[model samples]
Target chain A: MSGTFNDVIQIIYLAAASCFILGLHLMNNPATARRGNQVSIAGMIAAILATGAIVIHDGLITTTGWIVLLAGIGVGSGLGLYTARTVKMTAMPQLVSVFNAVGGGAAALVGIRDYSTLGSHVAAATSVTTLLDVIIGSVTFSGSVIAAGKLQGIITTAPVTFPGARIVNMLLAAVTLGFGGYMIASPSLAALGVVIAAALVFGVSMVMPIGGADMPVVISLLNAFTGTAVAMAGFVIHNTGLIIAGALVGASGGILTKLMADAMNRSIGNIMIGGFGSGDTAAAIAGPAGAGVQSIAADDAAIQLAYAAKVIIVPGYGLAAAQAQHEVAALADLLEARGVDVSYAIHPVAGRMPGHMNVLLAEANVPYPLLKEMDEVNPEFARTDVALVIGANDVTNPAARRPGTAISGMPILDVDQAKSIIVIKRSMGHGYAGIDNELYANPKTSMFFADAKKGLAELTASVKTLVG
Target chain B: MTLLTDFIIFVLSLWVGFEVISKVPATLHTPLMSAANSIHGIVLAGAILIAASANSLIGYILAFLAAAFAAMNVVGGYVVTGRMLKMFKRRTVPASAQAPAVNAGQNGGKSA
Candidate 1:
């Protein structure tokens, strides 16, 4: 391509990058978030078109290369569009995981191809970046697949571990980095191949032992890995656009990971270690506080809900699993008809991912303003007349406030403080944390035993029957 | 000097990303993530460039795969993020007025 044309392309890329930054900025608020996304798409389209123009103007592409390149774009776009359109809001987390896999794999390939072509002519900077790219990208690719598999139940959601799991993780880490170091010095294909293989295994081992509840943090971390790998790929290819976009995602994703982990009161280092058996110790330390629980019938629970001046509903993944979001919304509608101030208290890590419960509720046409974050909603619980918990367990557990429990230090919705509590549950099974929820045993708490959908439906009917 | 400029750009961009994205509320984490995912699809440009110079069999194969992956990352990423954000919009803005910023009502209605 000519110098003028390349300069124009670079300018175009600069404008697109600005769009991305501004788009993200606009995402800071719900009002402008959609506009932010559109702005970003405009930038991406410009960048893609500019790149395509470059390829055509360069006139060096073989006929076969063009066919493969164009066909690949067409196929990938078709799949991406199809998957994105068809995926349910509840399944967005895993879909994001799969997309992370694709992005990571693609970034790693960029590094791999560049290194293969370089042979021994690789500069120190390029070699280091390529090695880093391959390691991080391959890890994200394989790790995300395992995450998606776990979510979809293709792999066990239970923390899978062997006796030497930590030791194996250490060995995999050692091999990946040790071989990666050698490749940086020698620049050989075999060493690079070994590094990729080791990293892939490490990704699998690292994720398998992580309990399903911690997936939001893991997914955010992998999203960062995807960005970092692409940035490294940018270094290998000397592309400024790649570096900027990659670095932005890398840093922002890192911040989001920290924010979510902090919200759950989990340490990043602990999550990254993801070693097994901590639950046993935490369980032992916490001891048994749950007993003498009270069970309430649908009519009784509905009585409390119908007559309460203020009610706060706490939902979790169980609610989504039961597809009871709509039912809950209907129940709330009935409560509101009786002059109850019904709103939702959404714990950050309530569902499998951050904002998951909110998305599900919104999809059910729950008013956005009626939904509130933990900080904003916690104090309101003290003034609440009824705390109706449907299918949510760990996030509302009073035990989280005390030390030594599996979920100690975690921030929970203050449902225990409400004057009366009605819990809708299928059974007395332990929550995802494997610790019995302490709130259940509270004198004011009553477990209304039924599936969230069934229980909520019955409550809605009961409220209509009793109050109508 | 060129390398120095690239490094500077990378550092500044990282700072910019952190500053912008840190302000996003937890309610929009999923959309913010998918949006950022689309941004990194700049790798599609790199893949396209490589495809242009690809000569041998192995080069062509690598370019093809990278292009496919990058294309998916670019196209699907924007589309999904847009869908989720559209749902958010339905609530944030009153149902009376739709924002003109995203007029692709055909595509936006899928996930909404």
Candidate 2:
């Protein structure tokens, strides 16, 4: 009867796993995405309950253990709900990083506790997996924390470097490996401590030199690390569910990281090496000192927008920073009423995080069909009467097509091809690529210096009076 | 208990993951990350196992923390992703707001 009971529990786990697979499949379409989340939540609930049954059946948990587990669940649930509900769309990337950190930290602790309990009696296979779990998990934990800090503006977004930074990283790696090797050979608790410590420190150093601009890729990379660590923890405990889920996340995160890097026209290998965007240093080198830029008033810009046959709005990080998604959507709605065609042109790396702009725009109830990707919208720019570039700089730069520039070979929106161009920005500032936007100086382009939110509102007001 | 079985399962899951996830549109990347983050919260099972069997004070403490972290990851990731998706399904701005930017009523129900 007991054997049958265990088999039944395993079958439940299999069912939960299937839910996960189906849930992910449903997330491919916008119309079905919400239901996909619901299905995934149901699977999670089932997984949690099934795991609880297994633990209870083992009869290993003492009264104190039960109390601790209940308290943990309560506190964790409370914290999770609070943050998920309270966090703004702007801080979504940092929140994701924080989740990644905790996931990684928890996986490492599981491996550590398991290793300490087994000591010399642990099998060679388990030992190897456990050690790897601890290393990757610990690294992911610290690295994710730093990444979150950068996104939250708690830490400087500039690439923090020092003399012999590469050498220091190498030395840390060697020491971590050496300690890991010692633990494998002897199975002592002290060696394990050293391994964990070295790995944690290495994590911080690795992410510190990666500038804020490169954080989206870094977050994705750390996400993959967290998944691999979880898989390692699964191996230690001999749990197939954990292994499958972890492997899935690891593989998906890896692919997303590569795709993001390709979108930026940079290699994953180069990004991992760090020191790409050094913040102000790169900005100073390509500063906009002598560019011939023409500034247009809100009403003047409104004249161009109100009468345009077709307007393509290109939104970037500045738009997100000013929380102008709703404003832009409102403007588009206003224009559409006048029979002027409007659609958003989204560059792959436009926002700080992957799909950052889409999430923000979605919040404003922008129609799903109106948000167009780079390739789909590039050809439409030439036919557009007015290309309204809002707070987007680098991705619109013509410099990307030329060799020897900071953003050489990067894909850009064809805003310059439009018959007339209107740019809304705060001032003549460089974008994250730390370079000037060549499109800003084009004869066809006129700059309107203002915050994205204010600029959109003003233009909306102006169009109302002028067009009516 | 051959390690090879787990290895094969791991390798196969990776392929399945790549195939399934690559089809997700760019619009859902945030939700995709959140969903994937919750899936890896399966590590909570390992934490529960260790906690149930832990005999020492330190072991119990470590396991408790691990369980807490994993639980947060699972719960927070799902809730946040759901909330974001709910916004995606919200009705596009009401067609009645034909005036200029003065109509804040449509967005009044939502918080900043």
Q: Pick the candidate with the highest TM-score.
A: 2
Model 1 has an lDDT value of: 0.83
Q: How much is B58 displaced in model 2, in angstroms? A: 0.6
- Candidate 2 accuracy as TM-score: 0.94
Q: What is the DockQ score of candidate 1, to 2 decimals?
A: 0.42
Candidate 1, A303-352: lDDT as tens digits: 88888899999887779988899899898877877788988988888777
The residue-level lDDT of candidate 2 at B6 comes to 85
Best by DockQ: 1
DockQ of each: 0.42, 0.36
Candidate 2 clashes between residue pairs 3 or more apart in a chain or in different chains: none
Error of 2 at A214 (Å): 0.6
